[model samples]
Structure formats: C-alpha cells, structure tokens
Target: MARRPRLEPRETRAEATQAFLGRAADLAAEFAAGTPPRRIRSFSEAAPDDLRPALAILSEIPDLGLVVHGPRGCGVRAPGPAPLAVTDLDQRDTVLGSGEVLAETLRALDAACPVAAIAVLGSPVVAINSDDIRATVAALGPELGKPVVWVRTEGVRSAVPATGGDAAAEALLQLVETQNGPREPGLLNLLTSTRSPELAALAGQIEGLGWRVNILPAGARVAEIALAGRAEASLVLAPDLLGLFAEGLETRFGVTRLDVALPLGAQATVAVLRRVAALGRATGGGGPPAPPRPLSEPLAGRRLALALPTAWGLAAAELIGDLGGTVAVLSVPHLDRSHAAALGSLAERWPDLQIHVGEGQGFELAGLLRRTAPDLLLGAGDAVVVALRQGLPAAVLDPARLIGAAAPEVLTEAVDIALARWALVRGAVQNARPGYTPGWLKRSPDWHIKQEVR
Candidate 1:
C-alpha cells in the first residue's frame, strides 16, 4: 500500500504577504519599544535603504568579478575566496568628479581580472557625487568584452542589509537580460540565499524529476547567470530575501516563479518537490526522499534566542517549540509584509516572544541578551561573537545544514550541544572585560537608533 505524506499544520506553510525594504531590525528592541511587534509592520515602507554587506553576498558567485567603487576606508577589502577589485577612490576623487577614475578602474579590471563578468558596486561617496555608473558601464561594457553592470549599493540606500542581496540579484538579472538566447529545455533556476547541501539535495530531487536546475545569484555559474532568462521557471528557496529576483525574472524574461518558502523541515520540502513535479506536467518520478521524524522537545524546558533572517527564524522558532524548547528572544535582520503571516502565526503561539530585528549591532545585542537571558543562543553573522562574550552557549546558524530533509534533526543536535555546554561557555568568559560602557549597557537597546520624524 502506498502511504500518504505527513501533513503538518497549515500555519507552517507559506502565507501571502508583501515585502518591503527598510530598517530591518538593526536591533530587536527597535520594534518592541512601546508597541506590539506585529503592529510594527503597519508603518510606512518609505524608510532609508542600505547596500550593506552586499559585496559579501555578491562575492560568493564564484564566476562573477566585483569592483567596489568607493573611498579606500569604506570596508572595501576583498573578504574573498573570490577575487575583488576596488576603485580606491580617495578624498580628492570625491570632489573632482570620479567618473574618469571609475572609467579607468573598469578598464584596468577588465585587463587583469579573468572572471566571467564584472559588477561595479557604488559606495556612499560615489553615490553622493552622483557617479554616472550606467553611462560608464554602457560605454566600456563592449570594450571590456563581457557584461559590466552597475550595482547601486551606496551604504545608506536602505537600512535593510538584504537590500545588498537584492541589488546583487538585480545586477545578476541584468547580466541575464543582456543574453538573447533560446530557452533551455527543462531548465529551472533555483534561487536561494545561500548555496547549501540541503538545497543541493533538493536540486537533486528536481533533477531526478528530469529538470536541469541552475541555482542562482548565490553559487551561480557566470554562464548560467548570463542565460537565466532562458530558464522555464524560477524556484525561490528563500522568498523573503529573494522574491525580488523571482519577480524580476518573471517580468523581464517571462519566467514563472514558484513562490515557495525555504524548504526547511520535512513537510515544507515535500511540498516544494510536489509543486515542481506538478509544474513540469509530469508525475511519474518516485516520491521525494523523506527526512526522518525529528525528536520531540529536544530542547524542552529551555529558553532560547534566535538571531536569523525573518522567514527562517520564524520557522525555526516554531520548530524549537515543537521539539520541546521555548524561544524567548527572536531576532531577524528585517521585517516586511511578506512576513506578516509567519510573524502572525508566531504571535498566536508565543504571545510573549520577544521579537527583535537587527543585523550585527553588538551594542544593542548586549541589551537584548540582558533583557531575555536565554539559556542558549542560535544565530549567524556578527551577533555570534556578542553571544560568546556574554558567556552564552551559542551556535552559528548555517543555511547549508538548516534546510531540506534533515533540517529538524540538524537543528536539534546543534541546540542540544549548545545547551549542554552552558557551563563551559560561561566559565571561559567569566574573567572577560565588558565590551561596552556601563552607561551604554544600561541604556535602552534602541537608544542610539533615531526614530523617524513623522
């Protein structure tokens, strides 16, 4: 007898919501200060934009060359396993019209860099000077013999760090727009925030269904990225951050997007595979591999904190409670309407759950941790260090290990180890000096964050 697949609660699935950029929580307290966290989404979407840490996101596209067009001290070094070119715009260049310098930089990079394509990322200085990036790119793109695109990422564009990701996505899409190629038969673009084994495994499942999958923007081939418009459909692995790319593909190339959630846990993953198979107009492929049932309440009676992206964090928060742990503090980089359903579901279950939004503000994080005092911390990026300094047993959230069939168990193991090592983690930091002044620590976590003048 053929058995039916497991059916999780409807709330665990994707909900319809709108996405906007801005002031994603630079710190969790930004939303919680004197208002309901859910009500924070009701605010206007006209907040500032930041093209931050986007270069980091772009660099991972192994075949894409990057040129950071900015002043020398704008954190412009190549945090690379990938090659990067910096324009090295000095104070003088800022005043004297840096267009010539930019043109010269592009030509120089084209000569030396042996990558598939080059992208010029703007800095706050270049953006203010109003650099004619499009004109320059158009002029030199043919001369350079490959795609040269302008990625508008001045530091202050949007307060959302993922805006950097969006800019990079658009730049990649521009590269695809340049190609006038025939669509490849059975090709699908798997759009994901990071290239993970779990996603790779999911890609394999789609491949088994006889589709050619090109995972994009992150870990995408320069060849594949250039020809993305040729794909039949775009499957979003993390829609909260990458929905823009999917929508753009649909608009520009007429590629259909399967607006699915990041397939973490078993149910979500199974749902994704079926959707793909259905889209292909074929159902003959065997059932997708089912991940084992996760242990219930692996973290029972423990208070935990999560610092993750919006969708991933909400899913993980629910999973934590399912496995027997309580998530007291929740921190995501940004929140928009696209996340309303997931956030609403979370609110329904854990009414008192502290919702904090931020990306890498250790000062504010210190205050958040003090307020929540979670037994363990699970997160990614700069926030991990802050957790360590305060002696909390912390684990980094790896997108690679956190999705697909085994994500639930993978998270459980990580959480268990973190909780078990609390004594060791705390003991090591017992003699450490405080990273902040007493005044700052005592002040509200959102003290430094300026409120919008309405």
Candidate 2:
C-alpha cells in the first residue's frame, strides 16, 4: 500500500501577526556598555558558520593539499583528518605584507605533498591587507601543473560562517573540467560532508536501484570532481551546508537539484528515496523502497525545546511533530534565507513556536529554559550540558546522526532515555544553586543583544 506524505502542510501565515527569529549578529553588534561590561551572557539560537564548513569540504578530496595564510592566532587548520601547511602571520607581516611568506609556504607544501591541487584559505588579516591572492595563484598554477585556488575565510568580512564553505566551493569548482560533453544517465552527485558508514548505507540503497552515486568531499577524487559537471542531477544531504554549492552547479553545469527537506524521519526518507527512484526510471532500474507506515507519534503532548543548526532544527521540528512532540521553542546559532520556504512551512505548522537566534548565549538560554520549562531539551553539546545542569530531560544529537533510515528512532530513543532519568535529572537540578547567572541577566535571553537590523 502507498503511504501518504507527512508534514506536507499548506504554506500559510497569519495575516496580522509577525514574529522575530534572533541571529548571532544581533548579539555581536551590541556595543559593550563598560570597559568589560558586567558579564556577557552571549549565545545564538543557531550554530554559527565556522571554519569547519570550509575545512570539511577541502579535506575530503583525495590528495588535495591545503595552505593556511593568516596571523598565528587565526588558527587556519584545514578541515577533516588530513594534514596540510600553515603560514602564521605575525603583527609585522600584517603591516608589511605576507607575500613572500605565502610564496614560500606554497612551495614548501607542494614539495612535501606533491598533490593534484592546492587550496589557500584566507584569514581576516588577508582581507585586511587586501592580499592579491588571485594574481599569485595564476602565476604559480601553470608552473606547478596543478589547480591552485583561494578561499576567502576572513572572519571580519562575512557575518555568516557558511560563507567560508561558499568560497571553498567556488575555488574547488575551478578544478572541475566541465568539458564532459553530456551527463551520463543514472549519474547522481551528492553534496555533503565526509565519508561515514551511514552514507555508505545510503549509497548502497541508491546503487540497488541501478544508479551510480558519487559523494563529494568524502572519498571523492580530484578527477571525480572534474567529472561532476556530467552528472544527471544532484542531491544535497543538508541544505544549509550545500545549498550554495548545488546552486552553483545548477548555474554552471545545468545539473538539476532535488530541492527537498533533509531526509530525517520515515516519511522524509521515503520521499527522498522515491524521488531518487523516479529519477532512476530513465536507466531502467528504480523501484521505491517499501513505504514507511505512519509514525506512531510517540512524543504526542510533549513540549520540547530544540537548540540546533538552523536547517536541522527546523526539519527536526517537523519530525518531532510527526511523532507527536511540540517544539515550543528553537534556538539556532544563526539564520539565513536559503531555506525561507521550509522555515515558513514550519512556522505555518507551529505558529507559536518561539525562535531565538544567537551564538553561545548561555545566560540567555538558561533564562529561556527556566521560563519555558519544556519536557525535554534536544540539541548538541553545550545545550545538553545546560539541560542536564537544569535538571531537564536532555538529548544530545550531533547533526550527522540525523541521517539514514533509523535517524528518527535514534532521536526518540534518546528522548525516551532522558525521560526515564527524569527524577535523577530533576534531583541534580534541585541541588544546584540558581546564582550561576544573575537575576537581571536571566530575565531575557537577549539581555546583551543589540536591537538593530544588520
């Protein structure tokens, strides 16, 4: 029997009401009152786009060497488990120009790794110095017989962290030779993070339908990236992570993207597989997997708060609702317009779901948690600590685990476990002193957040 799609609600918004979702920039923009303000309770509702996105993609390509160019404190480490070179600039270099150091750094890395390609990541200092990296890379790339690309990762330039990933994708795309006449039938490109057993399982499922899958930045060779222009279509594992990359591919290579929600719960996963199988019909080998039955709605009547990355938090809300949970509030490290439609859909479904956007706002979260008093707290590391300390049932969910056929159940099981320990969690909360944060600060999550539009 065919199962109906879930959470496919009509897009509707209240005619008169408007709500604000906070962002990290709001907190950072606040002018400190004193030389060192009484104490800042800084945090955002969403995860900040850090250098991890840039590093994750660069380190995934096989034999790709990295060279970080910036001040010593910039900490320009490449993403992933791969090794690379770093050119730490001092105060003198910032004023005098680090051109000589950059040239020497590239040469040393090339000599050490002899890689097919080299990626240079820029720090705030490079941006400040107005470094002409393009001219340098153009001059050296031909002589080295390898593609040399630069990713502008200067923290001062962009308020959003994912911009680093965009810069990385733009650089890496230069390495792809889009001259492969036409896309091969049944070829699909997947844009996500590195290799994992869960991804392998997904690949196996797609392969079972007679389609070949190529995952980017995870076991993908330089040549494979070059051939990406020839893929029939592309799918994004996490829209927040790869939306821009996919957009670039579509713009440059004419690869159609399956713009859908992240495949988390059963219904969402089924939707993804069905779409893949439908695309596979051209190659004569796709049959949708058995439709997932309606979720039993285990979290019904439960109020929960979610502290997660923007995209994941929104999707998880829908998933939680499907399982009968109410996401009363969500805290994202940041917010962007890429998934405005999806966010809108979620908002339509849960109009009263309060959203707080900021970065590392512990005091704010503590206050909000106290006020909301949700049944469970679902988020990543710090959120877990906050909840556990407050005696709330808490579940720590790494964004990576929210994939594959079992993702929904994994989250539910964690929620169940946390709930089972309710008494213990409460005991810990009861014994703790409430003076960790002051009464004034705990009054509002945005106590120090500036009220301005960036």
Candidate 3:
C-alpha cells in the first residue's frame, strides 16, 4: 500500500548468475527417491511444464522484462504482465554460438522499456549449446545500465518443475542488497503464493498480531525485494519453493528464517501464528491466542487421493487424513533430500499409502487413480481433468488455499460441492475424451518407464 523510492539496480557476480549450471545434476536427483524408484523414460510431459514454476517466482516483479536466451519460440508462449525478448537462436547460432544475438537483444529491450531489471533466461537449448550467458550478461549489463540477471532453466535437465522456482529464487536474490542500519522490528517476511482473498486474509491475520507481512517473489516489486534484508525474519508458505531464497536472505542479511511446517490446516496455521508471536516478542509485541480447532473429526466417510508437489502433498495429505478423509495415495512431482523428514512424517501416519513420484505425467496419475479408486481426487493444474473423465469427483487444490483458521471448513465445503456434482459429472464423463487411450492406460501407466530401463 505504501510506495518506496526506486533505487539503482546493482550489477552482480557473473558466476552467481551462472551457478544453476553447476546445480543441474543435483536438481535432477529430486526424482531419484520414490516407492517404486523413478527412472527416466523415452519422454514424459512435465505436469505443470518447466517454465511455469520459475515464472511463478520471477513473475512477481510485474515491471521487469525477460530476455529469453534461446530460440525465438523458446520464450514463454503465454507470458505474464512482464515484457519478453528472445535471442531467436537458429541452427547457425546453435552451431556457432549466439553471443552477439544475445547482446543485441539485451540492448534493444533496455532501450525499449523502463524495467527494474532484465532477466536473461537460459532454456534447454542454451544449456545444451553451452552458451556463455554469464559472460554476456556481465559484459552487456553495465553498458545497458540495467541489472541483467540469469534464471537457469534447462527443461531437459531438471527432473522436477519446482526446481525452476529454485533457479528464480537464486537469480532474484542477487538483486537483494544487504541492509546497513539496525534491523526493522515487528517486520516479518512471508513467502507465499496465495492471491486475493487468501492473501488478504493471511495479511489481516498477521496484522492483527501487531506484525506486518511482506509476501515476496509473488507480486513484489524490485524495490520491495531490495528492502527484504531489513526484515527481522522470513516465513515461507511454500517451503520447497522459497527455501533457497530464505537461506540466501539469511546469509546476505541477518534475518532469521522461521523454520516450521507450512501453514496448511488450522493447526499448522496456529503453529505459524505462535512462531510469529515468538519472533514478535523480540520487538515487544505479543502473539494472538490459539483458536479452537476447526475440524474435530475427518470428512464423514470419504477417501482422497492427492497429487501435488512434495512439501505440499505431505502437508495436505496430513490435513485431509486428520479431518477424517482416508488418504489412500500421495502423489508428488518428485522427492529429494529435503523431503526426508516429511517423508518420515507421512510414513508414520499412512505407512501403506502408495507414493507415486513423477512429473505431471497424466497417464501415471490416471492409472494410480484407477488402482486406488479413492472417493475423491485432488491435485494441482489440469491433471484434475483426468480424474473427472474417470467418473470420479475431483477438486483442484493448492496447499496454500487450505491455510487460515477456516481452512478445514473450506475444504469440507469443497468436498461437498464436488460430491453434489458427482452425478452430473458421471453423466457427462463419456462426452469428454481423455488425451491418453483407454487401452494404453489399461495396459500400464508406467509401460514406457519399464521399456526405457529394460
């Protein structure tokens, strides 16, 4: 609500912008762990796609321009409000290197628009070509008088799409200059993906506790990020997405990160409030009293199969199970070292629940759903389309939406709505054809995986 003065964007280390290249193999390892053990196939469709997650994190800067450093079509097909440019790499450039083309694109974008910074994004082609993107940015950034940041996005290299968010986090933090004066008190930094009512509600809850929330890398301005170093602590809603960014802030600035489970259900929300209060007490403020539990029992007698990312899947599954819904299966985009504790936590509760870890491979999810036959299916993005065509009631849920004190009631109402429409959905199920063939799904969801390994 308050306006901050625009500051000059500072140039960063060329190596820092290129750091993602070194982490590519490590990023791919996130998928190595699963009940069945994940393996690369001939080809698999990224559930949410690779760029969406990075864009979700970087697109927070509505005023920034993105210079995609690959083929012309390599840029975002449906870019958010931010302006975009491309090197338009051709066969000639791929073989000979496109340094000049990248330089030219960067200059043109700087002269055309007034942007806080220009993000130089490397696509899979760029990675394959071994283009010197860091050197190009380092050479051209100062001349253009803009902070040129590199977001490392090699679609072929990253096994999990959420790793793109990690790239965006690393790149954006380069712009966060360290604070010099005393740290700001009663100021809490929150990393969240909630929009509108959910976001407004979360802010109001924090404000009621005499603390202010700075929701970052999601609709935050460059200037707002620049000032993050001054906050007392950082709170992450999507811990898996923002964990690296939080650590970067702590290392750059002295801001402590509130290491806690994301606030999904009523209990987690209360836990977050308590932690905020404990931090606020350092600034001479008290926390709100714990509220009554929103859900006393589970969802009547319904069973749910959820497909989501690791951290979100774990939290949402727990919440649903706690609320009385049988968590028959938990599907994740991928699992990595960070998920070790959460995996144990999940196993402790639902040891027998099958964990399907894969990219947003629709066929696999369809197969898992058929095998499990849960009462309801919940997941992120268009994967819900698969569930509906199977004549099962479904809902699209982001774990963030399940936050706040009223989360349980909201989830229950959502399940009720899906059940009410079940008959109508079943009636129309035959009308909509699934992308995959019925015979193929019946054959095996993981037939390709088996073939590749064999």
Candidate 4:
C-alpha cells in the first residue's frame, strides 16, 4: 500500500481554522453515506478545569443532557442543577477498551435521565483514542434511540472558551427544524444560539412586524423550536452556525430560506427589510406598510470611519454613502480577499472616501484621525478608544453581541437599531456647543460635577 500523505505543520489560528474546515468537509462527505457522521465536542487537547461557560451555553436549551466522560476523580465540575448526568470512564476502561465504559454510561443515562445528545470532553488519556470513544458512543446511540453529538478536541491548545459553545450550537441545529405542522404565513423564526442585548432588541423589532420571531435555544425551548417548524420562513444571521441548519430546515420543514447579506448599516438593513417584506407578502402575511423614511440623514457633509469585521465594514460604508456620509477610513484585520475587492470597488465608486486596513493597534486610529479628522467612528471595541481620544462620538457594534444561530432578519434589525442609535448620538454631539457635557456623563450621578458661578 502507498504511504499515507504527510501532514503539514499548523503555525497559526488561520491555519488551524483551515485544517478544521478541511476536517468538517471530510466529515460532511462521510455524512453523505447512510450512517450518521460522528459528533464533535471540543477542540482542546486537555479538558479545561471550568466547563461552566460551555455548560451555561448548553443549559439555554431545555431537556439537553451533558455526559462528561472522564476517569473517576478527574475533577470535572458538573453543570448546575439542570438534569445533567455524568459518567466516569475509569483507569481500567482506558487500558482496555472504552466500549464497556461507554455502554455502561449510556445504560445508566437511559435509565436515570432523558438523553437528547451526548458530548465527549477529552482528557489527556481519553484524547489518545478519541475515535474509538466516538465509535463507542455512535454504537450506543441507536440502542438508546438518541442522537450522538461528539466533539473531537484531541490536540487543540487554544484558550477560546467558546469552542464548546459553537459545538453545542452545531448539535442543536442538527436536531431542530421548522416542519412540525403547516407553514404559518407572515411568521418567521430567528435561528440563534443565545440572546445578547442587541439580539434581544432586534427580536422586539421583528415582533413589532407581527412576525412570531422564534429564537432557538435562547428565548425558546426545544418544544417551542419544534413548533417553529411551521414558520413561513427562516432567517440565518450567524452564517457559521446557522448555515447548515438553514439548509436542513428548508429540506425538512418546507420553510423558505433567505440567505441575505448580514445587515451592518443602512443599505444592507434596507435591503434585508425589503426582502423580508417581500417574503411576508408572498406568504400572505402582508401588513400595512410603515411610512417610508429617508435611507439615512445627511452624511455627505460629515466625515466617518469604521472599525469592524470585514463584512460589517463593507455594509457600514455602503450605508454611510446612502446617507451621504464621506467615509474617511475603514479598517479591520484578517480582511479576506473578497472583502478587500469589495472595498476597492466601493472606493472606485466613491473616490472621495479614504480607507485603511490594520489590526487594532493603540496608535493606529489616533494617527489616522489626526490626518483625516473624521467626525464619527463606527466600531465594536477598539473604536471606543478612537472616540475617547478624538472627542468624536462612536458607536459600538460588536458582532459577538449577536451570538448563536441568529436569523438573518433579526441580525439586520439589530444592526439597524445600533446604526440608528449611533447616528442620533453623533448628530446630537455635532449640534451641541463645544465643551457641552456629554449625556452619558450626566446620566452617571456618581460623577462629580464642578459648577462655575457667573
């Protein structure tokens, strides 16, 4: 037999991501076979001491059971009082085969609790034969009549706590769909993992449209999610997590799927809303149109800069142009080629705009602002620093604030609200007299106010 191909070294997170994606592709090919593909639990070499972050994320889903497989006295904490069941894979099991241990664990779980899914947390020893452990679970799942979700975190070393969170989202999407009954006209379900402050607000906005927004594993339980199968359509906001699920929902539930661009600014937002409106009309869920509003207030006279992820920056710039804003600069690290090309096209379309690309360095924004003197900054985290230094009002629009299997419409609405708030704040700041106290400062009663008597 020919020698197996040698694997290349991984030196960066991007490289690791590519490797992971490759593995996912291979798994997808395997899944195409009649048998179910093995589940992935975590991406770490050794299970971390605290699984709270992961467990807390999983707890959002009702009737979800976590099965922790480790040697006795392994010191893995059980998830807080939520129907969680744990099984110890002892030393003897590791030396021999994991088949018996896993079988016993499954039997115990089947008798004691309701098991919807099973995730494996790799210890140093367990990581050795993760494939065998996975196989053991798969063999037992059919016997127990439950789906097995395995996360293979064999050789990873990153400290990113959300790896398990992503795995959980993936598992849920695999199970939930929109096909329990006949489709409801004008109703849409927002597929998301968890609710952030921004996402919560977006859900409210969609609800205002008389659309029943179903947030998966966040505001709604598993039963409610099953009921969401009847929604007229589904919107996928977090592409990475919701993409696979959206495809499944369309196939199983007969729900129309809209894979619109994520809304980050005025133009993308309007486009998304229009698409949603069209979907509603098609589904006989049409309602009276809200009064037409200007795409954006006059932005042409003002200078603005954006610091965000690639797609978000592009969308923001497009919307800023719609509002007549002169985009002085835009920046984001890890700028993919497509985003770069899009930015180049936008620059060619609007020659007056200036754009910069860089990672979030302390001096980067200050230096750019000194040269460009932008009137406003739209960013997630680092832009706040620019705003403080330059006395320019800034908006926070972090994508992390929109976690989980978010519906596209809900994502669009969240961005719309954030942009609106940012624009209003910037406008108020621009209209204020120089040295006028900021509203945020006034709102803080604990702050010392020095009064000058005339």
lDDT, candidates in the order shown? 0.69, 0.68, 0.69, 0.51
Error of 2 at 146 (Å): 1.0
lDDT of 1 by residue, 1-454 (tens): 2332321111122221112122224212323343322212323323433444467667777777777778766545435445676788877778776888888877786677678788888888875677777788888889888888878676464445566666766787788888758877788898775776777788888998878888876776688787788888898867665677788889988899886766777777877877787766542455544544645666779898888877788888877877788888877766654666666667667767777655555766767888779887888856677888876788887756777768778887888777677677676677778677788778777554443333
**Highest TM-score among the candidates is held by which one?**
3
Models sorted by TM-score, best on top: 3, 1, 2, 4
Q: How much does candidate 4 score in TM-score?
A: 0.53
Candidate 3 backbone clash number: 4
**Candidate 2 TM-score, C-alpha based:** 0.83
Least well predicted 10-residue stretch by lDDT in candidate 2 = 8-17
Better of 2 and 4 by TM-score: 2
Provide the global lDDT of candidate 3 against the true structure.
0.69
Each prediction's TM-score versus the true structure: 0.84, 0.83, 0.85, 0.53
Say what the RMSD of model 4 is: 14.0
Residue by residue across 40-76, what tens digits does model 4's lDDT show? Answer: 2232222342243345545566565555565655424
- Expressed as tens digits, the lDDT of each residue in 1-454 for candidate 2 is 2332221101111010011244322222221221111221233444333455677778777678877788665554445544577788888888777887887888888888758888887776776676666667777788788888767565453445655666677766777643345777888898776556777778788888878988886667777777778888888885655666677778888888987767787777778888888888879866899988867877888899888877788788888888888888788755554445555666667766667755555666767777778988888778777777766788787766777777778778878877887766677677877635565544665555543332
